[model samples]
Target: MFPYFCLLIVTSFCAITEPFYKKQKSIKCILLSCFIVLVLFSGLRYDVGMDYLSYKTWFLSGRGFSEQGFILLTRIFRSLGPTIGFNFFVFIIAAVTLYGAYRFIYKYSSAPLLSLFIFFCFGQYFISTLNLIRQELVIYVFLGCLLPLIIERHFIKYTLCIATCSYFFHYTALILIGIYFLDRHFSAIIKLSGIALITISSPIIIYLIENSDYAVYLKLDIFVAKVTVLQYYLLALSVIIALLYFKCFQGKPMTKKDILFENINYINILFGIMIIMFSNTPIIQVISRLSYYTMPIYIILIPNFISRLSLRSNRLIFRYAFILLYTLIFLVAITTNGKLQHYVPYHSIIF
Candidate 1:
């Protein structure tokens, strides 16, 4: 909680001050503080995330490395002993993921620090460092590589990035590639219609996972869960936000670059909603897994949409509205300690 608030203060303060802080030195300090708080909070924490023990167990056992890349990574981490190695591994993951996200938010967002705040409100960074370690690292790294290529419409480069990411996290990376490609190419009518198709097909996905011999190999059991009502509310909120951003862009005059970036984010939010809707079926966790690629869009889209509004009064109302909205989301996340995602009270091996 201490580190969490520290990060919030830094980002929020910088959000207000960045426009006036023109000096390169001042800008560096602000950015440094942001990364410093993020790294320390996420890097030093011990026994915090739900998967902490499990990840430690894997490190100690020296297993679960699917390829030479991970095998070498684990070896390097464990060279100093399990605890030290695990913390180092965590710090590396935290640094890489947070930095990548910083680039993503800074590149596409209207308010970079505020977009980061939204990322914090959603608990994206903490959960990535603490719980969903391998998957999140792979996804963000892959995502960073994918964004530019996607905008350039360089399919070959995007495919290579996906393949590279697969080396780190395997089939999960492939799943994201498939989902994102479809989202990018699909028309609005087809996008919504495919949602219906996916909803109807879940039972089949479930049936195959439940009874198929391949389920064990594919690890489909991990995704088994019933979608809750709270998730439905979140899903609805996402749809509203996506729609709002889409409509916001409709009336604006923008360059091809701006339009391309906004439209990509538009796809991200919409696809994220589609994936969340699919959670209502048997393979609930799969949607959660898939949402990672698309969820970052909201961090920027929300801020971008509000800033691009036609009325000053409307912007003010939404500014406060989001302040309240993010505040509640942040508080609820803190109270839960990421229990749902397996994160919580800050702990550190060094302490």
Candidate 2:
């Protein structure tokens, strides 16, 4: 709890100070400081995250690795064995995840520090890294490779990127290939209809998968539970913010990057709605994983939308609103989720 709060405070301070710095060097220093804090705090943790024990055990025994990349990483670190090696493994994962996220935010975000704040606070992305190290790593890979290809409208490159990432990483990431089509300049009506169709069809797909041999792939029964009420509220809140952005851009011209980002956000909201719609189903985990693929868009979308506001007062209002709303969500999540409950009384190898 102390460590998490410390990170929030540090990130907030950096975010507030960033716009005033102006100098590239000063900005880099500030960003670097925040990144270091993120890496060190995440890397140093012991028994302080959702899957810390499980991952450590896997590292020691050399099993439970699903992805080939992760298997290779485990084997490389097996040389150290036991505690020391596992700590190093966690450190490497933290470094890779934060590096990818920070690099993406720096490249795409209007306010990188604010985006970092969201990365830490919104949807527990930073916290979840302790549990989903491989997923987060694979997500960043998709963002780095698939994003540019989608924005530039390179079909062949996009397909190849998905195939390559899927082979090396999680097969679930292959679900992201759907984004390439969704990224196109489809009319809003068509896109909205598609969102509705997907949401509507989720249960049917879940049933079919459950009945088939592929049920093992989804692992739907292991973590059977409903998404929390607070989670649904957050998803609803995301949709509202997205709608505000949608209304703002109506009838306005958009650059290619902006158009794709805009659609990406809409797709993100669609996943949010899907989670809410399927809150009761066994397929909640699948929806949650799919949601993660688009979740990074929030770091970019929310900040970009706020910056686009026509009035300074509106900007300030929304900025504060954003922080407050997410802070409340963060509080509720930590209290409610069993895995997040483990985040309390943070421990580190150094201490």
Best by lDDT: 2
Tell me the tens digit of each residue's lDDT in model 2 across 263-337. 777776677777766665666667777778777777877888888888977977777777777777766666666
Q: Would you list the C-alpha lDDT of every candidate in the order shown?
A: 0.64, 0.75
Backbone clashes in model 2, listed as residue pairs: none
As a whole number from 0 to 100, the lDDT of residue 222 in candidate 1 is 54
List model 1 lDDT by residue over 181-278, tens digit each.
43233357865675667667756765776587655634544544655544555566566765764576565565545554445555554445545544
Model 2 misplaced regions, further than 4 Å: 144-146, 154-161, 199-223, 335-340
User: What is the clash tally of candidate 1?
Assistant: 3
TM-score on alpha carbons, each prediction: 0.79, 0.86
| Candidate 1: worst-modelled 10 consecutive residues by lDDT | 178-187
